[model samples]
Target: MEEAARAGRTLLGKRLLVTGGSRGIGRGIVLAAARAGADVVTCYRTPGEAVASLEQELARTPGKHQVVRADAADPAEVNRLVAECEASLDGLDAVVNNAGSFLPRPYAELEPEEWDATLRGNLTAAHLVTRRTLPLLGAGSSIVNIGSTVAFLGMAGGVHYTAVKSALVGMTRSLARELGPQGIRVNTVSPGRIATEALDEQPAEAAERERRMFSSFTALGRLGTVDDIARTVLFLVSDHAAYITGQNIHVDGCV
Candidate 1:
């Protein structure tokens, strides 16, 4: 099924800008877009093996691609990143606001600083990138904000994280209304728990506990994958989802 899907180039000739595209879910979307025939410009925060690997993979993909190092939360850096994208890809057809940070802690233990950082990393970063990229995105363009299922389910220790994610849904609605006349679509893709490097970093007991808990609750009896979210993003940015906007589509397996 996956092989058959890859054979269709849904985003042929389109140019895309994906933030935090060197690792995790962002990395998956980057490769998927490339395979679907979109010229991609993606940004990473730091230099590492993941970035190196992504560069190698993008080189092999048929479409024009670029990987840059920039801090999504910093306005100055975001400006540079967008400038590079415009220069490399010529113009943008889509933007995926996928750069985010998650810090789980009890609401009582969450300091003001931590709350502010969480908002800036997730919500503010998306706003900054989207604001700057709007001019480049003309009619028929789309924007997909990477939200989380926690925004709806409300995790116990992720108040700050969930708050920002919930805000993203509201943002998407507002943006869709504002951009609708211009023929641009805006939407959110809220993902459930997926096996990523971050999940593997959890302590043995905590990881196992979550695995069992989510498995029992999720109807599919399995966690989602990066590819799961990536495929949805591809569709959202493609003409297939042209009529879909201002909505939060949960990629979670019916949790």
Candidate 2:
């Protein structure tokens, strides 16, 4: 507990904002940032028990937290969310673009709506949120874009998801170049197969087979957890990474 407390205070006085933060990997990042003493403002598309539970959890931390509702695909909503966060906190020190949706439809049968939704939520959303929050984020600011390994290694059925994830890395590098002179860092965190609600519905045998496939490819012989990605992000946003920027760090246990 003492060691945990010390870790929680590592980011004292920093302010952060995360998108799609009501649950899953987003929730893990929010909790980690709060525990590290950063005032966190997280956004969700819809509210439910998870949002309330997150509020209670964040309240126990040393820093402050705010939860808002925003659909990343909507530019108006993204602007409002950033405004709300800026109003609640004095300014933004870090922004994590984590809101995304993935539907594995075969390329031969993919619909126009599916393609639009995937790109809007995954790629366009990051651009909108960052542009809106640019004024609030100043020198020493960090922006971490959450991507997937599927972007690097294209998946057979998730063409849309992989495309958007790949685009994000390009976006990060370009933004890093533009923002570097201002002392703001931009990077991408590409995670491997992480067990989440999306994967929980698979048959046990199928799941095991899939797990084994991923484990065989990973040097660590296992899948990643939300906490693993969260901890890596926390490190990137902290002062410890002051000299690091414009890089894509794969957190997939040596994939």
Candidate 3:
């Protein structure tokens, strides 16, 4: 408990904005950023129990943080969210594009709507957030786009999702070069088979079986935790990684 309250200065006095902070890996990044001494402004798509819990957690952590209801995929909402970030933190030091959706559907069953939505969520959302927040960022600013390892290793029934993730890598690389002179860095952090709380709720036998299967997929023979992804992102956004840009850092336990 004492460790939880101890704030580190890795991102001391930095201003950060993260999308999709209500749950899953996004929530991990948000909490980790706050604990690392960043003044964070994170957004969610809707109001729910997740928001309530995140608010309570942030309230207990050091430094001021804001949680807003906004969708990063929507242009209007993205604009509003960035406006709020500027209002809360004055100017941004970093941005994390973590909000996205993935629904597995076989090629034959995949519909046009599903393809469009997945692209909007996984690819376009990152563009919208990054472009809108560019004004607030300056030299030494970092932008980390969350991606997936399946982008490299294709997954059946997820062609649309994989394509969107693939686009993120391209986007990150191009932007890193384009923005390099401005001292703004862009990168992608691709995670593989991370075990989250939802996995714990699975039936004991089934969860164990799934974990075993995914663990074997990696050279390390163990599934990843949210901390694995979060820590890599923390380093990328901090000054410790000042020279790193346009790189895709994978936290997949060597999968």
lDDT of each: 0.94, 0.91, 0.93
**TM-score for each model:** 0.94, 0.94, 0.96
Which 10-residue window of candidate 1 scores lowest in summed lDDT?
A: 2-11
Residues 1-255 of candidate 1 have per-residue lDDT tens digits of: 966765688888999999999889999999999999999999998899999999999999998999999999999999999999888887899999999987789999999999999999999999999999988999999999999999999999999999999999999999999999999999999999887877788998998888888878799998899999999999999998989999999999999
Please write out the lDDT profile of model 2 over residues 1-255, one tens digit for every residue: 988777657788899999999888999999988888899999998889889999999888766788888898799998889889878897999999999987899999999999999999999999999999999999999999999999988899999999999999999999999999999999999998886655667998888898889888889999888899999999999999999999999999888
Cα displacement (angstroms), candidate 1, residue 22, comes to: 1.4
- Please give the clash total of every predicted structure, in order: 0, 0, 0
Among all windows of 10 consecutive residues in model 2, the one with the lowest summed lDDT is: 192-201
Clash pairs for candidate 1: none
**Candidate 3 wrong stretches, greater than 4 Å:** 1-7
Regarding lDDT, does 1 or 3 come out ahead? 1
Return the TM-score for candidate 2, rounded to 2 decimals.
0.94
Query: What is residue 12's positional error in candidate 1, in angstroms?
Result: 1.3
